[model samples]
Target: ILAKFKSKGSLNLHLWTNCDRKSMSPTTFKSQLYTHTGERPFACILCDRKFIQANLLTVHLRMHKMEKLYLCSTCGMSFYSSGALWVPSCNHTGEWPHLCKFCGKKYITSGKLAGYLRCHTGERPYSRLCCDKSFHTKSALNIHMRTHTGEKPFKCKCHKAFSERSNMKVHLRSHDKS
Candidate 1:
């Protein structure tokens, strides 16, 4: 796509596939490096940050000057630049494209899928065992082994593990309940 644009003698917008949207242009890329490194040839007395581009330096100076030009319509919150509004989140409603080959469950990220694969192979090694039964995952099998060993490694200074801390806390509370 970029090759086609270059061939047509239209060099205004280069289709930079790998660069960030604002950083696609060569001028912007160089300027961004200068901005990030605080090497502003045009320095503002109000703020210490420097920018290679005078216009960008002016905007940067406004920040130190506490000048807010971009305002949010929703809550009237102000921002120094329009660029401050963008935030990526895991709020997409699209179906997960990666399907687990073993269990057919879909996952949004590769890490979750990798963890799910361990369930199929039962490959996680145990540092401890419950009674004679072996299990995967140290945290899981440790909690189970505690019942037999009667050991509580997780403890508070008050000699109590909160309900969120360990299952032993819940089990200990159960004893009081009975």
Candidate 2:
């Protein structure tokens, strides 16, 4: 049937079949019927988003109300999932759960491992619109933006403003002389 559809150079096949158990497998036909009918059994009570499986619905519920089931033994920190608790706890005890394949360096979380991998790849995802320069982190990119904008956000008691905090600290020391 699929070969005939492909031969015609078009894929507009109307699959209208009688309820014959011998023609098609019951399990396959049921799944196809569900896809066409949009029959989603599992539904979220909070958002009313439907899922085919109950386990998917249960996982989706976490976004609405996260229940902290796992607790860190070392820091007493609670996490919604076991993986979240395990990663930071490993970092605290100097235990590297995840390792880099390129440099043999270790990281507690997969996210840290991914960021470290970018250093080897030289892939800076954060970029500035004003300049062609890029940074590894958003905070670094934000700080770099102040150089272009000349934005003095930090202020002192003397009403003196500075672009960077370290510059403001240096200015404060001159006041100490008096």
- The RMSD of every model to the true structure, in order and in angstroms, is 17.0, 15.7
Clashing pairs in model 1?
Answer: 40-50, 40-51
lDDT agreement of model 2 with the native = 0.68
Q: How many clashes show up per model?
A: 2, 0
What does candidate 2's lDDT look like per residue over 141-173, in tens digits? 767877997767666778888877799999999
Model 1: per-residue Cα lDDT over 1-178, one tens digit each: 1211133345454334433444337777556565344365876665233458888776776665679898766556777777653211121345575679987998766666776777899787544422466555545664675576555444443465422345556656767886
lDDT of 2 at 113: 85
- Residue 152 CA error for candidate 1 (Å)? 48
- Please list the residue runs of candidate 2 whose C-alpha ends up more than 4 Å from where it truly belongs after superposition: 1-88, 150-178
Best by TM-score: 2
**Alpha carbon deviation, residue 139, candidate 1 (Å):** 35
User: What Cα-based lDDT does every candidate model obtain?
Assistant: 0.57, 0.68
Report the Cα lDDT for residue 98, model 2: 87
Provide the global lDDT of candidate 1 against the true structure.
Answer: 0.57
